[model samples]
Target: MKPNLSLRVSQHLALTPQLQQSIRLLQLSTLELAQEVEQMLDENPFLELSSDDGAPEPDPQAPADATYSEATNADQISAGDENDVETPAVDTPDDWEGDGSMDAAVEDGEWGGDGTVRSGSGADEDEADAADLARSHESLTDYLHRQALSLRLSELDRAALRFLIESLNDDGYLEDTLESLAVGLAGADDAEQLDELVHRFTVALGLLQSLEPTGVGARDLAECLTLQLHAMNLHEEGDPAVVEAALRICRQPLDLLAKRDLRRLSQLCATGEEDTRQAMALIARLEPRPGRRFADVERNAIVPDVIVRKTGRGAQQSFSVQLNPDVMPRLRVHDIYASALRGGRGGEGHQALQARLQEARWFIKNIQQRFDTILRVSRAIVERQKNFFVHGELAMRPMVLREIADELGLHESTISRVTTAKYMATPQGTFELKYFFGSGLGTETGGNASSTAVRALIKQFVAAEDARKPLSDNQIAEMLKEQGIECARRTVAKYREALKIAPANLRKAL
Candidate 1:
């Protein structure tokens, strides 16, 4: 075997550190990006937030020819693909990424400040404050403990109750047998002691079950429902007969209730079909996961990357895209540090400071490029999905990453990076950028319809459907066919399931 050296031209892509940072920043969600910025601010003295007032003002200390100015240099932009890992040769002036600066200026304005493309700011501070409360919700045990304080229980009983409360899972289920908890307190050395411990546990269990949620400390689903029924009975809630019937139903195998077998349930409860239906309805209103609300149900702390707003009214009505100032970290280089480094008066620290200064420039420029790419992509999306904005998801046209990438003169991967974890707030709702792109479905007129539109249509059909005779997937497919869309029964089923709609049998009202 011999090794030969030959001259061959080969092309390769390298992910430089700056390019990698750009990609990372692009993919981070609004909240995550804010978190990353805070971390960077703490770690790097070079990076600091630009004014919250919306525009990156040129540093007063900077010379007229400073490389790190308000706007990036056109020549440098042409040289750095900003994305070819900075390949300017393939970039066009019309492309968003070409100049490495945002074409549209993002002003700090309220969400509903301007109609079709723009929506009201649903993420106001009040909602955020409420969400913050939810974010810091107390554990179920702590909640139960507070409720226990109002009761006049002995110290031993209160301790046992607290222990029981702690033992309950986040879902409020007590999975372990009383014998297990008893053994922990009363060793296995003596059966009599264990029996006494079990008796005390039995009493504690009753008090624990009496908690506000009604079903807390329930051994199983059946017992949980029974405990709730007894509480309802004590409070004289619901029709006496209906409450009685629900208790009887709960006492039976829970699987029968879950299957929604009205026939079997009625037969087992020895009640008529109508009575069984009423009983099922009452049971349906009960909360299965009692502690779910108390659990740290982290509400998505979303701040949109792009905001679409309505500009004009009537015939002149148009939507414009802009970066959200809230999500876009107003970052600028630290003035004092940059000036000292530039003056060359900060001796021995000049080299390290210079590197940090350069890094700061790259970070700010990359961030600027990120927003510009996002704004351009958003504009193209708005242009393509204009009908969707006007008429809702039903009018959303077919779109793919390739279409946007081709239109913007960007690689599909770059488009993907820009779309991932990035959200845009529009009149309809705040949606991830990827939500706007969907594969096409064939139409009767040899055209194409967005799968999103098809799903929207299916949702409408299901919502308007009769409860007594719910539409099946096959029927839905036939309905789509009537509307000039070619969809299969299985495809309809898939979409139906995606919308979290139950099957026809399950959807049918008793």
Candidate 2:
């Protein structure tokens, strides 16, 4: 064996901590960025919000102009070779602690490397105050526990019921059966105890089924439906004959009900089609996932990063894309703290303070960069999608991330980060940044059409369709073909489903 040595030259990129943070900030939605701003303010003492209470009240337009400049600067900085594979700056720490990536974010800004940030002035006008919707919701588990508190039972019975309550899934279906639960409890206690636990669970099962949801702790879909029916039996809407008919229909195959096979259902229930139809209507009103409504679902606000408003009238009309002031945090280094940090103080504490000061400056700069990238991308998108703004979605052309990346001299991934979670408000209303990018379909004129445009066409056709004789997917495809779209029936069906339109039979009036 022999070993040979040779000198080789190659280039690769390493993402700095600050660059990574900038990328993350770029992708975060408006609400998330605000939360990040609040967190940084709390964690970094050097960082403080810019305001006009004690400070001198400046011109309202000052922050807007300042924001423009900051965004421009960031765009200028990152408008480099975006395709550099080794551009490892996209991998920075999420927070400003430890290595402090914020330092790496803004190289030449107001901070000027010495890390002294001049406090900013007033807020931007476009930064509308976000509508706060905070409500304390009672979770499914908590709701069950509260009801359990009112029940009178022995300790063992309550324990077993509580265990069963805990075992129920989010949809209020019991994932584990009493037999299985008893088998698992067998190892924990003697046979007599196991028998007692089984008996208590059996009794608890009936009581749990009687919860307000009417289907809280059932074993399967059939059981869940049966529990609801049982509850409805005691209600004012309850019809004894209807309940009897429904019970007979439910006891048969589930597949029959799903298909809505009216004649077959009537035959199976030994009733007329009219009776079967009424019984099925009762089932339709039943809540399948009773606990779903109580889930603590966090509803996010859609605050647009860019606002595109039309300027000029008639032939001179054009859209102007600018940053939304509400989302851009009016931030700077605390003037008092920055002045103190600038004074030549020497100590271990002094170095730590200096680091914190730098972090604050970096945080401000990175946030600026994030908005800058967003603005640049949005401007480009507006430029490409002007037809869409003027003529509706049918005028949209095929676009990909790479096209914007090439035009802006940014990496494809950087473009993706800018588009994700970001939104634009325009004359046609607000839409996601990624919504404009769609695959091309060949046109009869040797041009390409946006899949988005095709979807829009499908939506229009369905909206105008006659309910008495709804257009099937095949008919829709034919209509598209007449317009030189060359659409297949399957494609029309897919677009129809994506738009949440039902099938022809489903759309037909009964």
Best by lDDT: 1
Cα-based TM-score, every candidate:
0.79, 0.71
Candidate 1 global CA lDDT score: 0.74
Candidate 1, 130-228: lDDT as tens digits: 356665778888889999999898887888888888899988999999999988877888999898778777888999888878898988888888888
Tens-digit per-residue lDDT, 1-510, candidate 2: 799899998755556656677767877878788899899989999777766344323323223333334333333333322222121133333442322223354332335322211222223555545443324667677788889899998888788888888888888889887877987977654878777778889999988887767888988877888878877787846787777778788888988887778789899889988878788878877888888777544454467777777777899887766666556666766766666666767899999887787677667777766765676788889889999999989999999999998887677887888888889888898899999999987777878889999999988998898877999999998888787887788888888999998888767643
lDDT for 153 in candidate 1 is 83
- CA displacement after TM-score superposition, residue 266 of candidate 1 (Å): 3.5
What TM-score number comes out for model 2?
0.71
